[model samples]
Target: MYASLVRSTVALAALCVAYPIQTQASDPAHESHHGKLGTVHFEVACNEAAQREFNLAMAYYHSFVMEQMKAPLERTLQADGSCGMAHWATALASLDNPFGWPGNVSAKTLADGAELMERARKTGLKTQRERDLVDALAVFFKDTEKLNHAARAKALEAALQDVAARYPDDSEATILYSLVLSANFNPADKQYGNQLKAAKQLEAVFAKEPDHPGVTHYLIHSYDYPPLAAHGLEAARRYSKIAPAAAHAQHMPSHIFTRVGAWAESVASNTASANADGGKTWNSPHAYDYMVYAYLQMGQDRAAHLVRDGALSNPTPPDHFAAAFSYASMPARLALERGDWAAAAKLPLTPAAGAYPWAKYPQAEANNAYARALGAAALRDAEGVSAELARLQALRDRATELKLGYWVEQIGIQTDVVRGFSAARSGDVKAGIAALQAAAAREDASEKHAVTPGPLLPAREVLAKVLLDSGDAAGALREFEAVLSKEPNRLRGMAGAALAAERRDDAAKARDYTGKIARQTARADGGVDGTQLARLSVTR
Candidate 1:
C-alpha cells in the first residue's frame, strides 16, 4: 500500500513537471513583471524600485499587441536610462514584426534601433540571462553587412530556444520562442508543421495561464491559416477582453472569425478594434478593412458603405505599415468585392505615404491593376484590358527581381486572370476559359494571407461565372463546387452553384443549394436583394 502511494505520487510529480505552473518568487505586488504570473523580470538592468516601469514596457513588447511600442519603451527609459534591458527591449520592439510582413520600421527607426542596441551592450548587463539576451540580439543588429534579416531571425530563434531551455519556469521566454517559431514559417506552405509545433507549446502554456497576453496573441497567429483557423476561435474570442486597450488585440480575433465565415463576430471584433484606440492608431485601418469585408459578406451593404465612406473621408491618413496596408487595400477591396466597375476604373494610381517602401511591390500594386482589368473587361475596352495585362506582367518581373517569390507567383496568377478576362471580352472565349482554368489551379494551390478579404473574390468563383456566361453549365458547376469546398456556405459560391445546377436541369441539386443560400441569408440582419437573387436565377 505504501509502494502504491509512492507510485501515485511519482506519477503526479511527472505530470507536474510536464506542465509547470508559473509561481510568484516573492511578493507579487513588488515584482518586476508583466503577464498573469508576474514572471517577467527586468532586474537585469535596474534596481527593484524602477523595475515596475520596465515591466510595463516588457509586458507590451512581449505580447506584440500594440501598434507601436516606442512610447512605452521611451517611458521605461525615462524611468531608468541605465537599464540596459530597456534599451534591448526597445530594439526588439522596433524589429520588423514577426510573420515576415511589413511593419512601421522606417529607415530612421532602423538606424535608431541599431544605435539603441549598441547602447544596451555598452551599459553592461548584470545577469547572465540579460547578457545572453543582448548577445542574441547582437546577432541581428551588430553585423547587418554580413547577416541578412533571414539569417538574423534564424539566429535569434536559436538563441531564444536556448533561453527557454535554460529557464523552464520562464513562461515569457517559452511564449516568445513559440512566436518566433510560428512567424518564421513559410506562409505558403500547406503542411503547417511548424505552426502546429508552436500551437502545442502555446496551448500548454495557455492551459495554465489563460490571461497571458503572449499566449493568447501567439495562439491566434498559430491558427491563422484557413485549415487551422477554427481552432483559434476561443483565443480570438478571449484576446480582446484580455488586452482591451490594444487596438491590434481587438483586431486579431477577427482573423479566425473571417476564416470561419462568422460575419457577425468578425464585424463586432473589428468594430471594437477600430475604436479601441480612438481609431487613430495604425491598427485601426486594419480593423476598418476587416469590418468592411465582414459587413459585405453578411449582405450588409449599407454598413459596408458607411465603413468605406468614413475611411475615404477621414482627413488623417495612416503613415505606419499596418495602416498603410489598410489604406492601399481598402478602396481596392471596395471596388473589386462589389463588382463596381466604374469605381474600379477610376481608382487612384498614386499610393499613400504610409505604404512607402512596399507600395511599389506587386502584391500591394496588384489590387489597382486588378480593379482596372475587371473594369475594362466589363466595359469591353480591349485596349484598356491590354494595358492592364502588360502592367501585371511588369509587376511580376519586378517581384521576381526583388526575390519576393510569393508575390511573383501571385502576380503571375493575376496576369493569367486578367488575360483571361481580356480574351473573353475580346470574343476569344476558348482562350479566356483556358487562361482562367490555369489561374484557378494556381490560386487553389496557394493559401490566402490573413490580412486581406478573400482574394478580391476567389479565382474559381470568377472562373465559374465566366464559364456560365459561355454556356458551359457543367464546367461552371465544377469550378463553383471547387470554391464551395474551400469556402463552405459562401454566398457567391452557393449562388453560382445553384445557377449552374439550374442550367444543367438538376432541379433537386438546384433546390438544395438555393435552400441553403436562402436559409443562410435569412439569418443575416438584412437579407440579400430579391433582384440580385433573380439575376442569378435563384429566385426567393
Candidate 2:
C-alpha cells in the first residue's frame, strides 16, 4: 500500500511538472487574473470573441465557480447578442450549489433561470448539440412552481444522461452528466451505485482531458466518500494546479484530504482556498471551517484558534448558508475538538447575529446549540444542557418545517448525544450508554452532509469517551479503533485509543496509538497542551 501510494504520488508530480500550474491564454481577449481554469473546447456558433469568453465561462462552470462564470458569460453575450449557448450557460449558473437540498434554490433564482432559458430558445440554437444542452437545462427550470426541486433534479439528471449518451465524444456533456449523477446520488444507498457510475464517467473524461477543471473537480466530488477517497487522490492533487485562481478548486481537494486523514494537505489546500478569496467570498469561511478541522486533527489547536478568529473577524463575510455554516462551526469545532467544555458552553449562538439571515439557516443555528449542549453535559451542568437541548429541539422543529430531512436527522443526532451525556452526569450510566449506542448507530448509518468536514463531534467518539470515563476500557478502545478505521489519524481518536489501551494494560497497543499522535502533533504549535494526548507520555 505504501509503495503504491508513493508511486502514485511520483506519477502525479510528474504530470504536474509536465503541465505546470499556470497556463497563459493565447488570446489577449481571454486574459484575466483568474489564472488558468483548465482548457475547455465548448464549440459554439458565435463570433470569435464570444467563443473565447464562452469557453472561459465553461471552464469556470466546470470548476463549480458559478459566480465567477457570470462575468465571462455576460461578456460572451456582449460580444455576440445571438449567442444562445451563452444564455443557456447563464441559466445553468442560476442553479447554484447543485448538490444542495431541494428548495435551497431561491424562487427568484429559478425564475431568472427560466427567463434565461427562454432567451436562449428565442435566440435560436444553431446545432442539435447546442439545442440538446439548452433543452437539458430547460428541464430543470421548467414549471418550477409545480415541480419540486428533487423532481426537477432527477429530470435534469436523466436529460443530461441522454445528452451524454447521444454525444459520446462530448467531454463537457459527459462531465456535466457525471456532476448531475453525483448531485442526485442517494446517500441511503450503501452500494454507492450513482457515485461509482459518476466516478467511472469522470475517470474516462480525466484520461482524455487530464487538465479539464470540471472533470477533476467532479471526480473529487464523486469519490468524496471514505470508500472511494483514495481513488480521488490523483484528481485532488491536480485540481488546485488546474484552476489555481478558483477558490472552490483550491478547497475542493481537501474533501478527499479530509476523508483520507491527510491533515497537512487538507490544511494547505484550505489555506490556499481562503487566501484566494481573501475573506470576501463565502469560500473563505468555508475553507476556514475545513482548516479548523484539519488543524484540530493535527493537534494544531493554536492554528485552529487563529483560523476561527480570522474567519469570525471577517466583517463583511458573504451572507449565505455556506458562510453562516462556517461562522457557526469554526468556533464550535475549536472549542469541542480540544474537549474545552467551558469554552464550548460559552460559545455564542451566532457570532455576528445581524450579519446574516440566521433565521433562514436553522441548520447553521443548530451548530452552536449542539456544541453548548455537549459542553454543558461534559461540565455536569444539567440545567445548561437542558436549556441548549430546548434550543436544538426548536432548531430541529424548524428544520422539519423547512422539509430539511438531512438537517433534522443531524439535529436529532446532536440531541441524542447531549441527552446521553446529561444522563451519565446525572448518575444513569446504563441509560447514558444505551442512548449513546443508539446515537452512534444512527450516525454510522448515514453519511454527513457536504457542508461539514464531519459532525461537530462524531457520535462514536463521544460514545468511546463516555465508555472510557465509565471504566469500560475495552469498549472504549473498540469504539476508538472503529472511528480511526473510518477517519484515520484523528488526534482525539488516537489519544482516546492510547489511553484506553493503557487502562487495559495493553502497553504495546498504547505505545502504537501514542506514537501516531506524537507524529501527527510533531509540528503543532505549543504542542498538545490541553488535548487528550497530554495525558499520555510518548517516548520518542
Candidate closest to the true structure, highest lDDT = 2
- Give the TM-score (vs. native) of candidate 1: 0.84
Rate residue 216 of model 1 by lDDT: 83
Tens-place lDDT digits, model 1, residues 422-535: 687678999988888889888978877655656775777777878888888899889888887777656677788888898999999999987876655543333445225423
lDDT of 2 at 225: 87
Backbone clashes in each candidate structure, one number apiece? 0, 0
RMSD of each: 11.6, 6.1
Error of 1 at 123 (Å): 1.8
| lDDT tens per residue, model 2, 1-540 | 644553454344223222223423344354643456778878898999888888888887887678877788888888988889988988777777777756367878888888888899888688999989988988888887788777888999999999999999988889899999998887677788999999999899889888888888888888888788899999999999988877799999999999999988997798778766656678878888898888777666656776677677655668778888988998898878778888999998656676668888899999999999988897889889989999999999998887777779989998998899789867899999999999988888788777888888889988888888889999999998998877888777888888899999999999898787777776555423533443431110
Q: How accurate is candidate 1 locally (lDDT)?
A: 0.69
Clashing pairs in 1: none
